[model samples]
Target: MNNLLDSFSNFSYRNKNFIFLSFLILPLLWLGIVYLGSLLIFLGHSFFHLDGFTGQIVYEFSFKTLIELFSSPANIDILIRTVALAACVTIGSAIIGFPIAYYMAKFTSPKVKIFLFIAIMLPLWSSYLVRVYSWKLILAKEGIINWFFEKLNLEWLLDTILSTPVIGGPSLSISYIGMFLVFTYIWLPFMILPIQASLERVPNSLINASHDLGANKRQTFYKIILPLALPGIIAGSIFTFSLTLGDYIIPYIIGTSKFFIGQAVYTHQGTAGNIPLAAAFSLVPIVVMVVYIYIAKRMGAFNAL
Candidate 1:
C-alpha cells in the first residue's frame, strides 16, 4: 500500500496535464460544496411555504412568499437603504484607508512598522461583539462623544446631531454616522493592506522620475500612483461594501430598529419563521456582490494590478 501510494504521488506530479486538471478541478470541488450547494439548498427552501398560524414551514411548492417579499413597500425601502449605506461605507473606507496605507508604504520607518501593525491589528483580535457593543455605549445618550462635546462647550454639534429629524424624530440614536463609523473601523485594515501592498510594489524610481520631471505631489499621485492603486482601492471597496451590505450584527447592536435588509432576513428566518421569504431575501446580498464583482472585472482591475 505504501509503495502504491508513493508511485501514484510521483506519477501525478510528473504529469503536467494531470496537475493542471487538478488545479482546475479543485476549485470546482470547493464551489460545488460551498456556493452551489448552499444556493441549491436556498432554492429548495424557497419552494417551502410557511404556515402563518402555526409559524412553521410546509414543504410545498409556491411563489406566494417570494411575491409577498417583492410587493411589500417596506422591503423595497430596506433594500434601497442597505445599498446606500454600503455605498457610503465603501466610499468612506476608501478615503480614510488610502492615506493610512500610503503613509505606511511610502514614509513609515521599518523600525516602527512592527509596533504600528500590531496596534492596527489589535482591534481585529478582540471580540467583535465587544467592539460593536462599545459603539452603542458611545452613541447612546451621555455617551463619550456627547460628554466630550459638553466638556468642550460644543453644544451646537450635539444639537445638530440630536435635532436632525428622520422617519419619526431625532436622528442621533439611529443616526447613519454610527453605522458608517463601525463599518469603516471594522474593514479599514482590509482596505489598508491591499492598498499598501499595491503602493509598496509601486517602483520608487517612477515617483522619483515624476518628481525629476517637476510633477508636484498631488500631480504624481493622480497621474501615476492612483492609476496603479485603483485596482486595490476597488478590491478593498468591494469587500467593505459587500460585507457591510450583509452585516447583521453591527447595525443591530449599534443602530436603531429601522429595517436593514439583513435585519429583514433575520426577522423572517429567526423571529417571523418565514423560511421561504428569508431564503428569497437572502438573494439580495448575493446579487449585489455579484454585480459589484462584475463591474470590477469590467474595469480590468485584476490585469491592471
Candidate 2:
C-alpha cells in the first residue's frame, strides 16, 4: 500500500495535467451519460405522436403535438398562470428576504450571523412534503389562521376576503394567495443566502466612503448597496422562478384545481399517457429558463454566480 501510494503521488506530480484531466473525466462522463443523454432522449420523445384511441405511442416524428400544445387555449392559460405565479413568488421572496439578509450581512456580529444563517436554512432540513402539508394545515378552513381570527373576532374580515373573486375562495388553502405564501416561504432561503453573500462582499470602506461623500442612508442604499446586490437578487430569482415553474406539488397541495405547467406535464404523461404532448409541454419551462438565464447574464448576474 505504501509503495502504491508513493508511485501514485509521483505520477500525480510528474503528470499534473493528465491527473487533472483524469479527475475531470469521470464527472464529465457521468454528466454526459446520465444527465444530457436522458435530456436528449426526453426531447426526442416530444417529436413522436401518441394515438388517442389506441393509446399507443407512434415512434414516427411529427409536429402535431407541438402545434396542439402551442395552439390550445387551455394549455396557453396554464402556461400564463404558472409564469405569473412564479413571478409573484420570486418578487415576494426577494422583498421578504432582502432586509433580513442585509441585517445578517451588515449589522450582526459573527456569532449572530452564524445563528441567523442557520435559522434561515433550518426549514430545508425538514422534509419538503412535511413543510407543504404543514402549510396545508395552517391554511385550512379550520386551521390556525381561522382559529386566530376567531379568537380576535376578525373572522368576518377573513370571510369577506374569501368571498371576493379572483384572489378569494371558500378557504385560504385553495386560494392563489395561499399558494403564493407557501411558495415564498419554501424558497425564501435561496434568496436570502445569495443576497447575504453579495452584501458581505461589499466592503465596509465603500459604505463609509459613500457616507463621507455626503450620501445619506437612503442614497447609499439606492446607489451603492442595491446596485451591487442586483446580481445576487437575479441569482435568487433564477432559482425561485425555475423551481416554481417546474413545481406541481406545492400548487397541488395549497391551490385549487388550476393547472400549472408541471401539473399539466404530469397529467399528460402519467394519466393521459400522451408522452409526446407532455414532453412538448415540459419544454416550455426549459426554454423559458434558458432565455431568463441569458437575460440575467446580459445584466451581469453571472459575475456573482
The prediction achieving the highest TM-score against the true structure is: 2
The sequence of per-residue lDDT tens digits that candidate 1 reaches over residues 1-305 is 99999999999989989978878898998899999998789767876778878877888888877777778998888889899989888898899989888888888899777666777678867877888877778777778887898899997877876566652225445777778788888877777777777788789999999999999999999999999898888878778888888888887876777888788889988877787988888887888889889999787555434
Tell me the TM-score of each prediction against the true structure: 0.83, 0.92
lDDT of 1 at 69: 74
Q: What CA RMSD would candidate 2 show?
A: 2.2
Per-residue lDDT, model 2, residue 151, is 100
What value of lDDT does candidate 2 attain over all alpha carbons?
Answer: 0.91
The numbered model that scores best in lDDT is 2
Model 2 Cα lDDT, one tens digit per residue, 143-260? 8999999999998999898888978887999888899999999988888888888889999999999999999999999999999999999998999999999999988778989899
The lDDT of each candidate is 0.81, 0.91
TM-score of 2: 0.92
* Candidate 2 wrongly placed segments (more than 4 Å): 1-12, 17-26
